[model samples]
Target: MTDDRCFRIDEMDLDELRDRTRDQTLIDAFSNWIRNFAPHVDEVIAEISAAFANNKLRDGIGLFEATGLDDYASDEELRRLRASDEKLDWKRISTADLSRCYCSPSFFDPQGFVFHLPAFLIAELNDEHPYGFIDRIYRTEEHPEGWRALLTNKQRVAIIAVLELIREHPDYQHELDDIDASLERFRGAQSMG
Candidate 1:
């Protein structure tokens, strides 16, 4: 018998990310956003390199910061990120490694955020527990005051799509207030573009 029951986005298998399953519209939106923003591996790498060169990585405690012995990321997680950048494959990152990016939105400058954004989007659509992903959307004040302004129109639109996705998800009903607040801010930003 066919498994006709609907599944939550976070409950699907990783391979099903593009399988036209439940939440396909959100998946396609995220995929299109990734393709539009991070179309080239070289460009992505260049952005990451610029962030590193410009000291744009953020000043707050990152997901990996102060990990005396209990590190949030693997010792090789950074290397894996570099590898993924070279390959343009978000799936190369393990869930734990993806958490490092999603959990610490303040750790990335605007450019760095752009670089890792696809991963955040993918994790949001797939990970069972995407820690801090929701906060990343609504905790706009945690980032530099000018951060939102630095994002390109396409990037802002991508964020808007994700916000809407979360706002409509039943699991996120409790976060409606914060999601609505962020939606307004982002929509306002979009209009100014």
Candidate 2:
């Protein structure tokens, strides 16, 4: 006996057809799309986050070396670094700059990493926020440090998501072009200073 009855489709309205057609074939197609596309987007984000983290580490190391400060440098030393009279090249400094001088476990925490970033650099990052929360938090004076902490967390998450996308779809690597453009803009601003 033939199984032709399994393939029969009665006439139906658009909505009815859509409802009835939600079968294994449709479900499998949706699943395939997610499997194929989601990862590429995620990979891009993760790579970006890793890049940012690496950059932070580099900045912290540079700071320690330039200042000749030990990891246990006193708060006085840190204050002096932040002071205008120190003539510190804030623009050229980064989280890595601080790492060389400090051995604190908190220093490596990605969320606390923002503390190593100069206020101005943080401002730039906020300026590029795809969401308004970064700008809003940065602008508010109620709790500057807290705001930075929040932003650091938010950025880390966003970058990780992008990395996941990149990982999923190597073919869509070009999706990083926009991120590159944004980075170029930031770099240009730095050069101008």
Candidate 3:
């Protein structure tokens, strides 16, 4: 395998991954992956921008908020939406498990695959630094998969933080909590593959 295709299992750290995957290369990869899966972020921005141009910013925000997407809109974006004439630099929020920005799954993949942001995230965290779970005692019959094992407290927290950021609507908070609780049953597998 090419070196780029290879990763050191020895260099893994959960704390680092939990806070933010310390590997920029991996982060960039995740950034691409997340953006690929969630195109609506941009779409929402476009709609908001169009509304502002039409001098209907308030109506636009209210309309989008009804769609349950206003929370993900950045403060600057919201401000700009309200103040259409204000010259402000509004940065788009990049979200998802891979990106440092916490995000919940807006929906599942069309192929009916379960969204595995936490799984992919833990796997990436394992690849990024040493002292990761792969080399630790968690591997065994309880976690024969080496990389996979029962979710640790830290892992749950990390995953939950990601979920808190991404949501279909603010009201879906309870559903996300339920999903997180359900995920507690799995081993910490290294990769989605």
Candidate 4:
């Protein structure tokens, strides 16, 4: 005997279904990320903070200040930002703002295997905010860091970037057309767990 019960899949708006799914996947991805990162974030921030205090996190990369690109900076204004001797002071935000919040242009490894993360971002991770955070690389490595998680480093970057683009320039077109396929990847991982 078989009993069939029909029910709604979700209360989400169909038009925004993909976006909602993508956000859910990223949020889920954060579950394990926060576990590993929560304890270390503070230590990382302390190191970076100490460096800043010592005037070590100085100078911009090329023409870009250590601040990287500002969320509010328009494309034309960004184009004007280039490498030069004139250093732009690091754009420092309060711990509350960075905690459980997303920050752009973050590097994974600043001093070899060591990293400096903003205290604010670390706070958010410890709190496990719904939207989560972004990981920026100040420098690239020839090898992978080997994070054996559902989302790879690049995947996390793409997902976070898409969300940021949606937040910063909702009207602008982006190259995130294949998000559904990516969502399936996350969905698969979730089911396994």
- Best candidate according to TM-score: 1
Model 2 Cα lDDT, one tens digit per residue, 34-109: 4565334334434444444433332232333224343555777755653421123333543343333333212323
Ranking by lDDT: 1, 2, 4, 3
lDDT of 3 by residue, 1-193 (tens): 1122113211232233435646675644434434442344334334323322222112222222212232566766645543532122111221221232122122222110112222333333323312222222211232223222233344434433333323322223346554444334332331331
Off by over 4 Å in 3: 1-37, 56-193
Give the local distance difference test score of model 2. Answer: 0.35
Ranking by TM-score: 1, 4, 2, 3
Compose the digit string of candidate 1's lDDT tens values, residues 50-88.
332322223322233323113355657744543333223
Clashes of each: 0, 40, 11, 13
Best of the two (1, 3) by TM-score: 1
Top-scoring candidate (lDDT): 1
- Over 1-193, each residue of candidate 4 has an lDDT whose tens digit, in order, gives 0011001112232224444456664444333333443334445445434443322233223223223353455655554543321232332434443332233324222321122233333333334322333222211221124221423343344333333322222221232343333444434544554
**How large is the C-alpha RMSD of every model relative to the true structure?**
10.0, 17.1, 18.2, 15.0
Residue pairs with backbone atoms closer than 3 Å in model 1 (clashes): none
Predicted structure 3: lDDT: 0.30
- Estimate every model's Cα lDDT from 0 to 1: 0.50, 0.35, 0.30, 0.32
